[model samples]
Target: MARRSDDAEQLLLPYPTTRRQRLEHLAHRAGGIARRVLRFVLRWLARILLPLLCAAALLQAFPYQATVQGVPFEVQGSLFTRPGLTADTTLGSWEFPDVSGVPFGVHVRPEDVDVLELTRLAGRDLPGFVEELRVDFAAEVPRIAWWLVAELVVGLAVGLAIAIALEMAVRHLRGRPRREHEVRQRLLQFGAAALVTLVVAAYGVLSYNENWVRESRLTGTLAAAQLFPGQLSSYYTEQSKAFDVLGSVVGIQAALQADIDDERTPDTAVRIMTISDMHLAATYPLVAQYAANYDVDLIVNAGDESAFGTSAEFTPEYRQAIADLAATTPMVWVAGNHDSPATVAIMRGIPGVTVLGTKTAVEDGFAVGAGVVEAFGLTIAGLPDPRVYGGPGAYGADAPDVVDPLQRAAVREALGMDDDEDGATDGGAADGENGGDGGAADGGAEGDPAGVDLFVLHEPAAADEVRELLPGQVRQTVSGHTHRQNASDELQDDDAAIELVEGTTGAGGLDNIVRGTERPPIAFSIESVSADCQFTRIVRFSIESAGPAADLGTDPATPQAYGDDVTVSTVYFRPQDVAEGRRCDTDLGVGAERPWADAG
Candidate 1:
């Protein structure tokens, strides 16, 4: 046995570990037992820690008390540290009640807001009064990540490589030929290589270098802040909420731009309802109901009053029938690309609806609602039929109107626009599988361009084109193809011509929309409030016809003067009733064109 021990010793190198090492290994085993006891306690701590974290998350997700008691311009922008800060706690009296578990209140002072607007912004609804400042946890991430990642990778690589190398070297020196010993040596070698690989792959290559990071992180600190209620903010938000609700419930938010000059301003009280793209046979009842009962002095059919476009989509009797539907009311009809010239002729022949499509002299005028004498005040001219890519889906025009005349003409020519033998417009050919017959591409008319009070068409781009074609001459433009109501506040003034959209008032989604919204889902687009089956009271207003309206304090019933002090008190038309359940249902819309999923 002694000789065998010597042989074992001989197998090891000169500086190999001796019998003393076994004693040290025993000491290490004792230390390991103590570590396991420590680990058992840590495991219990970790279990409790997870539940505490869950409770914290729950508390964070629950909404806190919201006290809106101060100003209309509440804290919408970034808070704190940005100046123009009003004195803190400049009280107009702020208070709040506790909410479900969470609490918050009127955290803004009166000095922080505009005084006159205080009444509008302050909270009438106070739900809480607790303020727990959370350190917007997202802000801490970049700082911790800053130079540390690369450095961490380097340190980890160096330390792990050394640890693994030491294990392998120690194994070799001991000359341990045990199966477990050789396995341990090979594992250490692999771990060393993996460490080097991870450092280079993750940190050295993937991480953004110091200079690039600095350029990107210039203003991250500017974004972080805690949310709390303020007086002016609350008041403004409440007013906005009130307007949004009333506007939505009232149905005008879809296409009526009433109160063009804000209620705050003493302007003419004008209520307008415009409907376009009335695909007559399909959604006539919905349009008729809106037109017959809604509180609109001016009801307009922008264009495509019928789906009578070419020989295929149009039947002369159907055209006459659709035109007859509007014969009862003083309807103003424009031509869509879909309407054939024959369909247009039938429309012009209709007694009640004055067709403003073919460009004629000053005497051959059209209707633009109630007032507006030809040549002096308002004028209506018909636009040529718009070009189509074989059918409707083939064409795609999205940019702003082309400015240069030569460029515009070239575009028209490229689209296959040319005059027919009778000098009438012969439609051009379209490009691609989606192309259509192109004719109305450049929005020019057949006769003298009398200054129109408004230009009407089927698409919004048509108005933009007419404006581009005539520069300053065309004042107001109305269009509809979306089969939805859209009104413009930006496009009106004294000598102001605005664009109005009145289409598919409440036929929900007759225009490719799987789901519609009361609030605009996209940032750039306006939210449309759908018209319900109720009687809508639209106040017809003539520009500058009456004196400024009285500030009757948010009361719709308050009698007020029109601009120029006209005492025109119109009667309220009664509203229709709802279909079945409570409010209007626009989401799960179904039916012919709606289910077909394409626009006119």
Candidate 2:
């Protein structure tokens, strides 16, 4: 009865008897649980994580390899082999000595491997698996290697911390007094192991830069080294010498290769071919062939068919080419600086050719200058070279030049728009009446004239003045005389126009011949226009020189000329008809419904 009463009294005394004793008892229970958990984790690290880390390090240090055709090759991922064939053939003998008599260690790629055979050996679709592995290897190898090192460091730190915690917990649970010196000793040993692990990780990263460990099968006979002195010293030096010799011979061979099939056929409703500055070279046959093959509807020559605009310069060959072109397709000619009065008359004499002169007139709200030819469902205006009126020489006598400000005002008067009035230039009756079905008004500019679709001339420098004469309505202007081919930026401003400068088509006469650069940069444009006066596509054609100077018989000092190589490309423009809810396929019929009339 007394023992039972004593046990009840002790149980009711809060068990630990004091606050400090109660706290110690709770800590002992927690330490025991922590120790058990730490031991399990330590076992896992030893049995699983440690082995994985070692294996990864070993694989990275020495990559796996396979024998192909009796030649050992280092496998790059699963699909490729290291040291490509070019490197092996060029540097193998010297860099990798052939210890064995037979040439071994030749480079191989995945494509060279027999997938069927590999699959048979592995009894599965090894090639497909290998392909997937290759992609993963390329993307993840570098990241994975660094991740492995990071894992090692983190695992070591965590393991050491847990080990120290477990030791403390064990001592506390066993009712042993904490030994500070023994704990310090255990910590020092674990810390040293962690430090050693960190050092190994750093060394492993550095060792990745070293070449893979492999025995060289090639024997170092040095036979080729003895035969070709200085060849093995630098691979680049040998390559440089070889390319230099090849370059000298390449120029001549390139000149002979001509490719006319490269010309691009227009994919538009209406096709207009624009050629300029033909200074009387034998390019008309090629030009005629291009037009006929592509089924060109119209041909526009911006001028300079002769050097001095002399009658004698129009040789039989030149005339014959022009006659043949006009025979098949209707052509329009604008006078150039080089075209004299005699030259103009000769061109006008051609049955299908219409020659333009200098004058000012207005159609719709926009002023139409002299040489306005309405054909192929569009209005084409032209300006003669300003040099023909007052600049520098005898070239001015044959044709009058009206590029001055006063002449431009006259153009306004012809369009029936008063100067300085600044009246709105859109949605006017005269705009619709001038060209009738032949013209289409600018949808953006109200009360403005339908305006000219294309302005043809011999000098691109006159574009600014021309734009001033026909504000907000000139879509494009074609010109030549600089003997260069280039197009201006698209008309982005409300009143800007595109200026296309045609390069020399006749190879620039003596300038090209004397320099031995007879083949010149010649370009023609295939333009597609919608029935409602919108352009859909403007494809530019030009010749690119594929051969070197020696082949073209050009002087080494002379610049390379465009020859047989032809490149076709397109230029973008705002679609006018498409925006107006009109289809581009609307047929406007062939030829004029009535007799052709000039905008006078």
Candidate 3:
């Protein structure tokens, strides 16, 4: 009886404990539970999330790429039928047009319009997932912001239904006892409901874009009808595409190549300006007068020196006439593939004016010899005007290997279709006497010569030969080999050296004599490079180097409309002044077409 009593006493008595001891035990139990739960969740997530992440990454690498369509859509709040909306652009701000009437009648009418900058950057330009992210919330959507809130409310209502269902299932399962089968069944049901919710969310987004969004917004009746030619569908399908192609073309009418320096005053510096590739004859007085209007301290031009770079339209007298006009401004000349350099030399020598590039001259801050110019402030190295890209019959895509699409088109057009129709292939046509009865010569493009690659090759000098001439002296340079109007102003630098293609004074008409209804239609580059102002303003006539990946075919008829290379004052200002959107109401300030080439 005594032993039994003692045992009961011991069992009832509690052990003495400090606060520290109690905390230790509690911590040990909590750590074990936490570790076990984390491991289980991680394991399950790894099984699903790993695969999902991998798939998402792979899809990003190969996202879909497509050009945007031309279907125009617009959204204007109900503000159309207002009163007194005179067609004036001077004082109309986007938030408030200069009209008054109904509080809610200012809606934009949708019509067919060519669109750009619409397509999102995706696997095409960025990762699919990343592209889908709306990084820019600034984009103005017509309607749907507040509506989305209501729509989200509706989504939550459906979620509440799922939650209620789950509550019912839980109550049913727990009413009696804990069953393993019941827990498993509830988990599966929860997953299915979650998936349905995700699907609905995606559907809502798609519905919003497909049904409630727009691409264009115009107000006038004439604007909508004229903008959307050939029914809305066809305009969306075809005309939009036509305009896009027009954007890629660099139409240059006034292409003058000169050696210039940006020291404000010329003559003070030995920088020589060499002009080339101007279809000057086509527009005659307009181009000449335009040149005369610009600053013409000295004008030394390379051959072709005519409207036709290789066209044999003018005889020897034509070359003489070219020299006489240039002499008015103490201009010099050199051989271009267009005329016989020997004959040109004799004619230009008449005024005691030196024939440049055939023999280097010590002027314009550099020494400009025959086929070369040597200046001090600048080493304006250049290739002989005759050193062209793709020799004789080899001007197009398949001609010994120039396969750029634009180049291919240019070569084909240079050679008349009726003439070279003898054999046509998907690749490209042969130049077959393309040089206008001059027995087409076929030298590949004036590429890097053996040792001509210089440290800084300016002015389309033989890329290879320049290296041999001044490999180390070149730090940064510019050149004009592509004949791409505003090539540099447009920032079409395919390489280094801060080099710019000689670029165009005029960007209009047939580039590379490409397939166009017009032949040698005049275009000129009124490009300017100012060091004092630290600006390069390119004022093209019909041609311009529009903004990057820009479309030049958009007509100026539309308000807030922008075109590619074929618009006047279609200016390409660069460096910094251009960034400021500087405009020249008259003087056009200092540029190739204004200060340098002007006969004044």
Candidate 4:
């Protein structure tokens, strides 16, 4: 009992008041508080940071589609890695090489542009249109920024929910009770995984940039190089050549314009500017500038203005541009092989533009004597390409506007169709006279109120047939299907119509941009007619290469010679010269073989 009492006394004795023991107790309490605070901070940080990172990763993995200015585009979040704008130019996907190292990429889906949109866009000039786009993009920045922010907020909310669900799923899979230490471990694991992923992605991107993108300078189509065999080297070479030619094109154009500006037109002369085979090449601006400089009174487009005679090519914008061009000077157009019946219909709809065939003849898709129309005090007639009319001898779609044979005959007769019993065309001249001299007579010349002043067709081969059909009525004949410039008074019998063949004013169409082939010079013909409707002169303007597409010599001082050839040559017409009357100071005819040819 005494021992028991003694132990109780010891227990009740004043707890040892040692300072070391008190210090040890305080340290243990402090450590517990610090651990709680650290766990709370780490938990919140993981919730926010993990979700944010996940949202960013998701955005980088997907692309967004949007349309601007009626054009479709694909936006990719590159995370400031590969910033660039690419365009589907039909020929190829072209990434603008100048813009790189940005956070995002935009790809223009040109294929998505409908006919109407294409037409609208087609009418806009390049420089001005680009400026407008720049302004529009700048104005849209705030909206785009706000949109991105909203996307981020939504993505963050989604990410947070997904992370919470995943955390619950992991706990369930482990079949373990939730613990503060486990949460900390998860946060650390997630951080490590994210860092490793970032490093791997960065390394891959760096490798790709070094191996392909940067080495190639981003000039050629990257897809083409990767997908097509034998395209890598050839494409780059072409691109290099193309960039080299641009400066030359500008310089050549300027020089040609200067020469044209210096040329004088006679006060009494009626100037006729001829262009053809545009093929939707965006050559109108250049043509318009040249026409304005020349002060042309009439503009004639021989044919091939449309590509494949598609309705899409005749957009409102394109039509408006044509109309604007016509507003400055009257325009006459003949149907070429490429100008379908529908294409012709569209052209006819444009104001200030005259589709040469008579209304009835056009409806029949044939060129008859009645198609003559008076413009600029001159009687002009056109022959539609027979190939565009479907039937026995024709090779095209049977048009809705085409009339039956009876109606066609009546229309032709009403307009002056002369058919003999043999079913061959006879007495087809504007006048009752069957055949007369082709020369333009003074007052009663064939082109007066009674005759056709200018006979126009699409192919040069058809000129002989037209001159035969029109006889002495046609003063001059024009054609352009050959995409070559030529002037000749074939047969030289003082009765042959002088044929003027203009070249491809569209510089061989827009495909030439990618063809990378040496192309013929852009050319146009200027026909100066006397006050009496007589042909005075035909001047040919052309831009060609001054020399081969290389340095003239091996010498370093020898400048590379390419696209410096700009020429303007005049061919004079003398109505009275008995044999081969047309004369040019330079050799400028079809084969450069006119008897009167002089290399001026």
The sequence of per-residue lDDT tens digits that candidate 2 reaches over residues 1-600 is 999999999888866878999999899989999988998787546534454444344433444344532223443211112221111221222122221222112232233444334334333443444444345444544554454345445555555556566657866998989786886787676667767665654654554422221112211112122212222234223334443222212211112111111223224667788888777766676567667656777888888776765688888767877898889877878777666566777887877777765422123211223545556556566655533322343223332353344334533443345556543232232232334334433233223343666777776645555566555556677787666677423332344346677777665665455446555656666666654456655556665433443466643222222343343444445443222432223244223212112442
lDDT of 3 by residue, 1-600 (tens): 999999988975653267786787689879999987986676445434443343333322322221222223333222123321121111111122222322222332224332233232221432332323222211333132343233333443444444545545655776945456866765675566457557754654454422111111122222222222223333333435543322211000011001112232222211123344543332222334344555433443433443333435456554454555555544444443333433344544556244433312122211112222221111122223332323344221232243233222322222222334522322111211111111111121111111111112213433323322333323233333344433323332323223333433323234445534233212333334332222233333333233211243442222112222232322222232111221111122111111101111
Supply the global lDDT for candidate 1: 0.34
lDDT string for model 4 (267-352, tens) is: 33577888888777545655665666566777888877776776887777667778888877778887776667678888888777
Residue 249 CA displacement from its true place in model 2, Å: 27
lDDT (0-100) at residue 99 of candidate 2? 19
Candidate 2, which ten residues in sequence have the lowest lDDT sum? 252-261
Q: 10, model 1: CA deviation in Å? A: 40
Please report the TM-score between candidate 1 and the true structure.
Answer: 0.33
Clashing pairs in 4: 80-103, 358-371, 585-598, 586-598, 586-600, 587-598
Error of 4 at 415 (Å): 8.6
Q: How accurate is candidate 4 locally (lDDT)?
A: 0.52
Between candidates 1 and 4, the TM-score winner: 4
Question: Lowest summed lDDT over 10 consecutive residues: which window, candidate 4?
Answer: 591-600
